[model samples]
Target chain A: MPLPIEIVLFIFLLTTAVVIARLEDLFAAAMLTGIFSLLSAGLFTIMDAVDVAFTEAAVGAGVATVFILCTLSLTAKREYQQPTRILPFIVVGITGAALIYGTLDMPAYGDPDAVPHGHLSAKFIEIEEKAFLSQDKHAAEPAQHGSGEKAVGLPNIVTSILASYRGYDTFGETAVIFTATIGVMLLLRTRRREKKVSPPNRDQMETTS
Target chain B: MQWLGLWHYWAVIILMMIGLYIVIARDNLVKKVMGLSIFQVSVIMFYVSTGKVEGGTAPIIPEGGHDLVYSNPLPHVLMLTAIVVGISTTALALALIVRIQEAYGTVEDDELNAIDGAAL
Candidate 1:
């Protein structure tokens, strides 16, 4: 019962992806990209990644789409039709085939005993377990609040891991965001005066600025 | 043999290849970026798939009790940061595109190349 919608969402995702790849109109493609992001967000939710889904819906579907439309306004709307090339198709096929062959060793989807679950994930889960599920009757040691070690003190284990365990990565992420801001500002700066030239001749438009 | 179990990974791979194909094959810069977005999201899907447990719920600690299996939180955290980074990349790429459009007056890869070839 739970998986029926899950499968449907994946199907929708695949469909939207193909359509996006084939569509030539940049406007429609940008809109479909938003649809694709929302569909992927739905898939994320079904896979129990609510936080990821929320962020994807907001950033991927919401902000990315708007930014794209903004770019579209400032640039060409219709993509110029070029003769299709086969070499890239062959390259994608070969890479995809190799990747598929590699997946044979990957753990099955939703496998609880997969290697990732055994390491730090289990401990992260246990930390929260000790807090709320003190009466856990599993083979693990009884929830001895034996030491004064406080539970993560937050309900969401994801946040605790991100803020504390992986704080350095978050710092790096912040730095990355800051650097991106600087890059955007530098790239978009129009320093010289602009001529009222036609949009097609925009190459020299920024030169005067 | 166990294709049924690995179907999700297969689809993810296909999606990735589609994204790669768009990046490699398409002449339009914006479409390539769209493909890049799809590719990034598909990778996110793969990692999130690995984070899922058969009977697991979201990685939030529940108030009533703790018998429920919570999916792996590490992947979610990593992917959260990844999504943020992804948007940043997209933003930065779009900025570059805007600059490219201004300087070349076109976003087509071949056209831009032609422009450069003429200059040389």
Candidate 2:
């Protein structure tokens, strides 16, 4: 019997995670993390989460990996030696066991009757269903649901909710990005006059730039 | 039935544990950041998995298919914002690591702590 595609992808993902955990070389770990994100994005696509897959592909594989690579250029590529790992390992093992125990009570995958699916999401899906019916009626039938025709006129419900229903939340997220960019600029940028104090460092910086 | 239904959660839990171990055990600050990214991605997986519906396609509504089942859109939207925020957080963290390297000439947690102890 052929294994499911997700099972194959999960195997690849687990392998990458293990390799990243054991590797001492920072650069290779960074590269593998990119592969890890790309694989998860593929998994998301297989799960019918195109919007999520797109965002993960863009942010995880693209921006996060680039950031790690840039940081690597500024730091040493090798990790320092640590004396012991027994405590952290045990701690993580316990936490993992606890999380697994908690998962015993969670709703199963793709369960339409799950609590999250049965309430607000059902309402949204209902709106989409009504919209489809209205479209089928060819102007002879009005939308049965008020929210359907007024759902920001976007066929992509995720986009509509992100930009319309949850507009303020998205605005807050954008503000967070803005703040982070400013913080990065402040942390990394040095004044031109200050650069005169460290001529060799200035030259290295200029060369890298 | 049980294993097939809960496999995704178990897989996610394992990934999360690996990420947590890296964050706690790694000496290099950059590796810690990578671990944190992995942890965040694992959480995204958890939420997206919960949002899945049997026989559902992408959340995009087709032109005239009323019977079509689309996956829940709310989680996808939330995770999109989360992905953007995660990238920004990673960017800022890396910038801090760069500054830490410049100041202490080391990115190892122990070395930085030792340097601080000496100064104190």
Candidate 3:
């Protein structure tokens, strides 16, 4: 039997990751990293996380690649040679070992009895289903649950949870984006200042000459 | 059978280790950012893997359907927050890299440290 598409894509993801790690040229690494992100997005889609995949494709493969390309243009493409790698290697090795050991107690993949499935998410699903069922019986009238707006009529439960059930968290995430946008604006603000100051200095030099 | 079930996690661990090694072993600032992105991505993978169901479909409810086995949506929602955070961090890191290059004329950690050491 042939390898599953997921396994094949996973192989590609791992290969790109390794290649990105080994490449010395920052520009090439950036491109490979974009490919890695796309592959991971594919993996997310395969795992039934369509929203996550969309965000990954946009943010990871698109915005991140553009940001890195801009940074690459600003900095040298080549990396400087390092003197020693022993310590960093040992540190990474130990960390990886610890993490692998920690995974020993984790629940197996796709197990219905997994702890995450038993949480409040299950309750959310139950509520959503009940709302759907009630909607069928009350087709002639408006949903009485409008008092609480509990019937998140969206077909995508992920969207409903993200936008309604966990609206505060989404608000915080938006605030985080706003903060980062401000940080970037502040960091790169000098260019505009320089642009404004340059013409006057050049004009003064020309007059003096 | 247990080992087969755990391969997904082990692969993620390997990817995470590679990212860690890049962050630790590389001197280039931009490369470190890339490694950080990879590390975050592996974390997303870990979370998404946990959300997978054996026979699950996407979470979108079809018309008048209630028996569909949808994969866990909570992790997907949480990973959306994480994905946004990752992008923000990457953007900020890149901005910082640009500023560092402007200041030191080099993005290499050792060179920046050496210059700072000389100044001190």
Write model 2 residue lDDT over A1-209, tens digit each, in one string: 11389889988998999899889888999999999999999999977889899888887888788889989988998786567669999999999999989988988888888888777787777775666556666656555545434544457888878888889999999999999999998887776455676888778877886
Ranking of candidates on lDDT, top first: 1, 3, 2
Error of 1 at B46 (Å): 0.4
What is the Cα-based TM-score of model 3? 0.92
- lDDT per prediction? 0.87, 0.86, 0.86
Q: In terms of TM-score, which candidate is stronger, 2 or 3?
A: 3
Query: How well is each residue in B1-120 modelled by candidate 3, as lDDT tens digits?
Result: 575677778788888888988888888999999999999999999999898877888778777886878888999999999999999989998999999999899999989999999999
DockQ of 1: 0.73
- The alpha-carbon deviation from the true structure for residue A125 of candidate 2, after best TM-score superposition, in angstroms, is 1.7
Error of 3 at A42 (Å): 0.9
lDDT, model 1, position A95:
98
Name the lDDT of candidate 1: 0.87
TM-score of each: 0.89, 0.90, 0.92
DockQ of each: 0.73, 0.76, 0.76
Query: Given candidate 3, what's the lDDT at residue A187?
Result: 97
Q: lDDT (0-100) at residue A192 of candidate 3?
A: 69
